[model samples]
Target: MLALTGYVDRLSAKPGGTIAFKISSTLGGEYLADLVRIRCGDPNPAGPGLKILPVDLPFGGRFRGRHQPVHLGSYGRIETPAALADVPVLTLSAVIWPTLPDGNAQAILTVGDPSGDAGIGLEIGPDGAALRLVTTGGTQTAAVGAPLTARAWYRIEATVDVAAGTARIVQTPLDPARLGLRAATTTVQVTGKPLLAGAGTMLAATPGGEGVPASRHYDGKLEAPTLVAGDLDTAGVPAGRVLAAWDLGRDIGGVRVVDIGPGGHHGVVVNLPTRGVTGARWTGREMCWRHAPKDYAAIHFHSDDLYDCGWETDFSFTVPDGMPSGLYGARLRSGEHEDIIPFYVRPTPGKTGAPVLFLASTFTYQAYANHRRGNLDEGFRARIKDWGANPNSPDDHSDYAHSTYNRHPDNSGVALSSRLRPMLTMRPGFLTFNDARGSGLRHFPADTHLLDWLEAKGIAYDILTDEDLDDEGVDLLRPYAAVLTGSHPEYHTPGTMDALETYTQEGGRLVYLGGNGFYWRIARNPDLPGVIEVRRAETGIRAWAAETGEYYHQLDGELGGLWRRNGRPPQRLAGVGFSSQGLFEGSHYRRLPAADDPAVAWIFEGVPETIIGDFGLSGGGAAGFELDRADVNLGTPPNTVVLASSEGHGPSFIPVFEDLLSHVNTLNGEPRDRLVRADMIYADLPSGGALFSVGSITFCGSLSHAGYDNPVSRILENVVRRFAAGS
Candidate 1:
């Protein structure tokens, strides 16, 4: 709990812009801060290895307690004063569909503070469905006999009669006949004063006792929770007698939770729950929530749901003018615990910038933001501790939320990903997995190897993100002579695609140093920053498949899946498309006959080796994980030349799912399957610009090896220098 970790207010800022930092810690200790540029994040000594260059700017401050907002559950809240003040009798009713009935106690409707024991609450937990009323007298409880089944809808009602000093709780399956279940009811006499003190806020799915640290989160869906002061007719109650009746379905499309109660006690959702989810009364008539929101009115609340960390600004740092554009972090150290809050600085606005523009795969980083791979073993732990790279991870900080690859508590795919919370995986030296083959750098951290190489080669380059390109379009890249991409530049938006395409078409050279890029079609709402939405429909490589008619994204109404499904297969843009993928193992790229072509012979200027990238930080060699291959059928330019091709990939490597019409033995590395090879492609565009694609995620990881003296580094240097001078 004493781990020192925090996040920044903004991801990228201009040279003159100010960015804030929010720090959190268990002990109140003085922390030292320094700005440092992060180069290579891979800590393996065999690799180019970790490089940190500290800047002179340093600051210190004192902080206390963890500041991370606990948004692990979503619940509706309504405060009623008159209803709980000396009320003789009160009735609470709600429709609930519990997902984890026997897992833990979940509150359906809680009034007053459960921690204080001041009012009444309807809950289902280890003791089964129960109603508790606490007052000045003491506490009285009423409970049913058996626990409810999971994933079943139930109409539960609880009434407290203060005058009669009796409490009654009843529960019945919405479809008892179809479900083959029976209803249960219990009545217990109470001796305590009527705990009808509705002094506390009414909370659905969570205990109302939040004055102190409180929990007992419900993992389920709730709808139409109502409260009445004086119980009259249980069958047909008059609306005039209603104290607070919340229509959880009224604002299904928005963040607001509406209340039809006379008090107008409305509420707002905390950590974004799965809205437009299947309600208790859903009949499968409409699958899309947009079609019939009322049918999908229920909000699926999870115990591990987190949308943002609403932390107050602890301190801020302003980027000085002429500050080099690169990856930097706020180094925080307290006692023995230390952390680095990373952020990117782009070139000053309205500037021509450097000759080389390094395009950070921000979208890809955001997509795999908090991926919990669960592969961190003891050996890996010892390695990171020894390497001083283990700061924080999603495994320890689940309050931040999981990646899109993970599922919600209700068993639905987490389609939305937000960066407002602490992105534990995006930090420097954050490994994706403990790979047995090679260094475990991936996504954001892995991309740093290229930056390390650029610095080692003394190459001046401006850093820009996919977001910047998406917003500014070709204008962002027009000034630069060449645009280079990071490793695993997989996720892309329409604007980003258009910008890169137009940039290259308009004489701006492109160097794609990655594989399986421009593959997924993701959407980030302009109105909602720090969040991206993806639906895996007609998938390429996927953890979970989207439902049939749910192929379109709810945020932008665009087809959400592989870019290949959107008629812009990666081959058209990067000269290669996704083909084969396997474990984190790599093979070498052998020089093809086409590399000797005079048109591209300069790319191999100082490098004489026919075999390229035999040694690398990623998977031990180049061309691993997800591989791409040049294909004319998928829009690889007709003039494009395959300079070199990777070979010796083991049987573990197999073609992507879309490439196969049927399973055959020839699918792996056969001549019939062209997808098994990583083709280093180069083509001259019509606008005097050129495209050079490494066609492998591991290609850039080898650039920093041997102090940038290796063939891989030499080849890349030749490309960048030539493109900047020639283009």
Candidate 2:
């Protein structure tokens, strides 16, 4: 299908600030463009679905698909000061566990340029491990007798005597079953080559060729690659002759490639390969990488590992003065293809008279970008197409890139996620969990229901994001009296958490409108901007578990995992923490006895129904997908009041792993069970600040029901109005 797709350079721009867009289209004609303020992104007719109003723009342009470079692959490269001309003899040795050996020629180690006749490399191919050397005379090759077995450890060595015009290859299987087999060896001779211009560039996973862009990427684990300068000795070359030696385990917490040789030839990893992984010699004695990093020395490189797409700008647009601070996009359409590059126009920095701020969950948006679940059925696909939703997903757009939820070609979980590429899921009408009950809204688009409600009720609010908070700290939230969270703000960094926590403690009101928020602790590396790293360590609803010692983050050296494991559960910040999760089915929340208390009676100002939000979109109720609860044991403030608790969750609902010591039958949504229900909480902070938490990710999804005149809407509106008017 012909379609228009594009990406914005940044997520949020201040009034008068510029944002760049890179548009790609298959249609050969001119495309129409305009600024649309997106209110609700859900295309379901059940709620305020797909509410976007166009803002007249004076810009028009033609766009066509152009070939763009997308670098994909993980490899290690180190520049050597010595040229290939100076080093006549070289030997390379490493331990490898090939995962996809027959797929392509994986260069284990290279000493020179492959394009010219002055390089030498050891590689694994369909025929087995081989050694190839290019000298001033000619190219010489050597290989083992048989192909290497997949997932089996083997010690491989290759030596090239450039002056002698001879090359030798050797392989010894480390696996117990193959220990009896004799070491395989092959040799070849060649006769005059020419000296290459540049110094030797050492590389692993692919050759250091100048002209070949796709130089056969490696997909396996490589550990401790060593290169020696002298000829192969009968007693093995002395340690002093080692030209380069790398210990892949030294800096497991960072991206520093340690060279333990005399040359000090350190290097760096690109495209963010999986680290702290199982390597050769791992005896299962220690699972934590920190305690036994030697066992985790291997780096798993893959041919399809991608972390960034450095695309040039098609055009830049500046938000004009007086443009309302809200959700906006560069709407592009050509022929039958359409795409909207969504971005937020934040208010100009200063004390704008607005009293409320919508903190868009940009971090969470980036974390789940381009996730490919591989469960899109024919019905779901047809529904998406009929509803005018952005249909391009990670499954269909491998050219853009995969998500952290996806795996590398070697089957290792992708730990790093970058926002540099086009995020197909962040667009309007992007369904993450095609619900059986209603539209499945998530991330950036799901959060727009609150924006639509705020606009409909004429609430004056400014929009900001987690990046803004992380960059500016609490200063960004200081001007607003109340700060509101988006649906499923499940990811956060220390800076963003600190800013919001400090803001709430310093008399700024907080309205946590979602569940499973401030849950996972992620890190943004300063060296790699727009990229976030998550290590799903101990005890949470996880897709992949981080290896033992890798629970700590490589970027910030902080503990990476759930905030609950960090001892600062969401309860400490918002008076409730994640307790249970299930399918995308929702049930209504019933008024707790505490809601009738004089302290929080105003929260239910116009709501007369004892059972609130029993019917709406988002699985048909106020609490669904994931739920949180107030717990004194997990740091829920003693003064916190539970205003309402959800009821009647289906059989799929179950307590989270952290809250369970055993799998008893009663842990499932029984009455009076603390872990089975979402608790709508209210608490006062140390200062004049206060927190009102809905404790459900789908709470906002019910706000658009009955034209925003329902009890859920009334209760939230009441809280927002009172909180905005306060200190």
Candidate 3:
């Protein structure tokens, strides 16, 4: 039994909101006070102190006064009987928590007491109740008759032992003189909540396990209750033994109970009565208890179903102030069920759980040469640039040949960044489960690929790929703490963006490891497969990065332009939009940062010039591949950060690499180029979309070349490790 406090006040007493403590009943929750107590709220908001609700077992209302008898009878049935129709039913609330069998497991139970108002049997599972009471327990049941009227104090107890697949019925009395016990029986059963000494309802019937159709009732005081072995035969018990021990007074909790009519005394059987029950009615103070536990330990979250839909369980054991740094899981069993939710624990209360993200990319790991002149790599690289994004990786499967191009784009980056992989995979090593990267491959869990390697390391991960998002849904990423993407993660679908955006804003971390990833702005028809509208300036689609003068209304759908109002780009909305470039400062480029920015040196782990330095790993301003930026259509908002910059590739001769930016369109009458080719994203500006680009192609080279003792590798390792740690 839990302690409770009650408190209430009018505006004159304690003005403002109130702080109420929770109180519940296991039998049948019908009253508020029976469950919780509370402390009133006031105007002076000094941030309150500790105050427990009053637990006056004998009292009714708030802690304002002493306990008083709670009784009300029709002073005279005038007109309305609305208030009188209220009563609690035992076995209607809390009772059990369940556990699933390692293998196949099934059980059966029997019933008694034809009145049906007695108890129920339940099947235990991890998340929800597997089974409810089976009305067909047995043919005979308990009896309520002259014996109960004659008895001064008596108690009846029925129990189900699942392990033995039996139900027992036992009768006891406060005085030894009144006692009768029945033999065990076998049949189907109904699960039940707790029973308290109070007025309860008759066994109501429904489809499967409803109370009998008899208008019978029970009245008495139950004391020292206990369940016995085997199903019992109530009719066999003698009537004198039942009436001899009538518990006329109250029980330990102080309440009354009695069976009405000739339903059953000590050895009688009455059919139960049932009807349509829309909702329950609450009277006064009442306690609620767990009748049965749940089935699943963890929920794979899905937006279609609200996350709050997750079950809320009462933690019987209070957590300690200082716990160790590790994962802790508990199985809470109310009766025979349980829910297992594991939490990351730290030594102190403020200690946090580390979030890991691994973003894979075909951009970095793919074999390609850096742009020597730092403009655009108009060579074989461009030809194969779409290789990974396109549908033409390998139509056929081969052992040595991996559909790398067709593989999941974000796998590598997300995995490495988070340092975690999937716990399960598909059969052929193609389909992936929790892994963020391999979702596109369809590699079976049993497949011997990168997925297996990850499992071997026991890395905490969920391998998911963009390909999965298309065939599947954004729901795949719901369980992750955060998601990461690799640099140059080009080519995206509107659906992909929807998933990424939802995950980030909904308290999920989204780390962009690769710039220009998911920036393709392709318009696809869910109905028509493979019919995508790419050009944003016309119709049937949109161009999220179109030029200013190139006004295109239907571009979003018909043609799908890159930059337009109807299909407006992100730069026009959120300031400081994402930007990219091939500019890298190395043996090339005139102006590299003066010794690179020292602020990022810490990120380099003491090596200041890790990304770009005297080693000349990264060349300056190679070629900005795909970058998002704030321009005319949508000048980025103020909050965006310009992490790095590059010179050249403009309208003026001041910078480097042939400055021929804006040029008049020979084909069209509108102005063609601008000073800086600011890239654009669709509706992604306000959220502070980011961009880190290199005017030099050597940036990728610098990063990839960072071998064993390479400074670049050291920098990346440090940064990635920290990222995984959620620092």
Stretches of candidate 2 above 4 Å error?
1-3, 26-33, 57-60, 63-65, 79-82, 112-118, 126-128, 133-142, 145-154, 172-185, 188-202, 207-212, 232-240, 246-267, 275-298, 665-674
lDDT of 2 by residue, 183-217 (tens): 67887665554243345554455453443343667
Q: Which residue pairs come into collision in candidate 1?
A: 84-198, 105-125, 134-195
Candidate 3 lDDT, tens digit per residue, 309-349?
11122212222443222222221123321112112222232
Candidate 1 C-alpha lDDT tens digits along 352-402: 457999999988888887787776678878777876775577766676778
Give the Cα-based TM-score of candidate 2 against the true structure.
0.90
lDDT of 3 at 28: 30
Model 1 lDDT, residue 226, Cα: 79
For all the candidates, what are their Cα RMSDs to the real structure?
A: 3.5, 3.5, 26.9
Q: Of the candidates numbered 1 and 2, which has the greater lDDT value?
A: 2
The better candidate by TM-score, 1 or 2, is 2
Residue 492 of model 1 has an lDDT of: 90
When summed lDDT is taken over every stretch of 10 residues in candidate 1, the lowest stretch is 205-214
